[model samples]
Target chain A: MKWIDAPWIELLRIALEVAATVAFALSGVMMAARKRFDAVGVCVVAFVSAFGGGTLRDLLLDQRPFFWVRHTEFVWGILLLSLAAMLFMRQRHFQPTERAMLLPDAIGLGLFAAVGVDIATAVGMPALIAVMMGVTTGVFGGVLRDVLCNEVPQAFSDHRPYALCAFAGGWADVALRQVEGTVVSPLLACVLITAGLRGLALWRNWELPAWRV
Target chain B: MKWIDAPWIELLRIALEVAATVAFALSGVMMAARKRFDAVGVCVVAFVSAFGGGTLRDLLLDQRPFFWVRHTEFVWGILLLSLAAMLFMRQRHFQPTERAMLLPDAIGLGLFAAVGVDIATAVGMPALIAVMMGVTTGVFGGVLRDVLCNEVPQAFSDHRPYALCAFAGGWADVALRQVEGTVVSPLLACVLITAGLRGLALWRNWELPAWRV
Candidate 1:
């Protein structure tokens, strides 16, 4: 029996990434409709924000031909959601605030980072590079999102603790993985750390020190 | 003494990618502004559409540290442009039907695919993966741009001659490199093929068959 596989957790991670993809896509559509952008532009933004981070993670890890290609379901979901958003946008714009995407987004941040770090570490990347990869996988998607949307990322701009929260969770997860003779699972460590940090940051308004030029 | 580097052509390639990046970013911002999206959403859309493809290609190729991280200037350019687009949006909303992006985007298609193929081949990737990388690098960004903006990618949409042109260019580039010792510059072959295909596509109204779901 493969005692270490953690299928349930993996499933949850997949589900979380999928949910985040949907939320992120909706975010793009909502913005596009608001801007009165043409159909092409709206769809482009939706796809990028939804898939950008995972694609980056997979690519850096040299895991081809990529997730969207393998999982027609993910691509299909995006297509259907995009069509729905376009058709009923005037009457029914998606509302992330109203929906419960925050927890899933938080899950995405942690899992993406943990998995990124694990891959980087396995490949013998330097600790700093691995950490950076972890953070990049975790937060770059949101940063890309904000930049395309035409603003400094809220975490980076408002001195909020977004990436840092992910970073902390990543650090703890990575560190806990090395405890002597402990069966501390990477997935469990990743989930707990990510969720914990994200929740704490939200509750306490934890923030990073802002750069002032 | 590195005498055969093709300085002018390399410069041209870099220049084209840069121009395409700006044009792509602008298109993103234009779309966001027209949709009346907030600043954050606009920036997110612009950044992802512009950087999403090449970034994905690099990461997938396991080009460590990633090109964007190494070439921080690209991020700076995208940032500056996204900011400008958001601020000046009310002054000038992008009209996609006006065709401001067709040429720059084509240049991007040619240059990015060529670069992606070059990078993949150098890394010893198999030919099929290399071509896929080239195509992904060339066209995925646009796919991404459309998705984020909440519309079906023109590549997968009705009668849009978008990705097929890029795909032909990438395959042609790969074939050119496979010639007898191919002392002939691979990138030059890529450039000619891509530019020709993309131009012919626009002029001749070439398009790929869309999925019939």
Candidate 2:
């Protein structure tokens, strides 16, 4: 049996997921170039940022050959994109501006959360764990990327509610599934909730509580 | 019920695992200092090197609280070690020559592999997956650490059979159990096989097939 529902709806989720992964992957590649990291370094950041969350989900869920293992295309997709981005960086025309990348970054974050909730639902994870998984999968890639770059992860920073935003959206997603009581398609409900709250978070400039030492 | 035949044996395992984790965590701290990574970077690398395998295993098994979560003391132990190493590095004389660090590094590799295999066996994953988990846990911390340090992991290098040696020892441990039946303690078998093979590999020098392109 196919795990995904409504081919078109699934496609919508995947399209945005791929977009977000590409966007996040590009961010890492750019950072690598700035750091003068070698070819392997560039690939490491790109791969970890793009695949870390899904890899964790698969590992936790015991889903294997792993998503990347089976779908070499996704790996290739990132490689091709990384190459293009690297080339563009060599020229000045297509230089990636960090400011311009935020939209895709937020969209990717929301899309990944939706995917996480959907996967958790299919696997029968409890609601809280599911929400946590969603948020972790959504934000952990960037967190890992930042930590690897020898900087504090924005997710852990108090300046912005990076992980908090993902967590809120994930909680909303799970809550919607429960309150709707099988009336709503869980996938659509998740997608809508994650995307909506993420948008609200960005627009409102949400911040989480933190104290500097 | 207590899982092991004798209390002393179990205590030995716990003691050894703690020592291995501490040693590995210190190695990570040393690497971070050599590169001048920040305090957050030190903590992250220490955590990953010490807990990365168990975390990955628990996540795959969907086990709650994770290993470190169950043994919060483990993190406390590693943290204390990291702090000591960092303070020591400020005034201590150390050179990260691969030649000098090889012995403890190899010992840690084997010990971690044994722990990983033992955990996977308890969780009842496939034997192959369990062996792979042992290897993954043993080497992946260094891989993550090296990547964070902006260097290529020696695992992917033509330099040596780093992961291959761990995989061999882990499989030997598992295979020995199948031959000896349940008479011998599996944990003991695991530790013996891992330490023996890993020690020999490092002492005599071993390498695995690598693709250079």
Displacement of residue A151 (Cα, Å) in model 2 is: 1.5
> What are the per-residue Cα lDDT tens digits for candidate 2 across A1-213?
253566775676667568768877977786666555544456657877888887777677766665555455787788788766766666655555666666767777777887777678768899988888888778888877776666667677736656666777777778777666542356555556566665676678776565768
Error of 2 at A212 (Å): 6.5
Highest-scoring model, lDDT: 2
Candidate 1 lDDT for residue B187: 72
Q: Which stretches of candidate 1 lie over 4 Å from their true place?
A: A1-213, B1-13, B93-98, B180-184, B209-213
Q: Tell me, by TM-score, which candidate is best.
A: 2
Candidate 2's displacement at residue A70, Å, is 2.4
How well is each residue in B1-213 modelled by candidate 1, as lDDT tens digits? Answer: 132256865566577578667766776766655544454456556777787788888667757666555566776677678776554543454344437667777777777777778778777888889888988887788777766555667667657666666667767777777773542367766767887777887798876665779
Q: C-alpha displacement of A122 in model 1, angstroms?
A: 17
TM-score of each: 0.53, 0.55
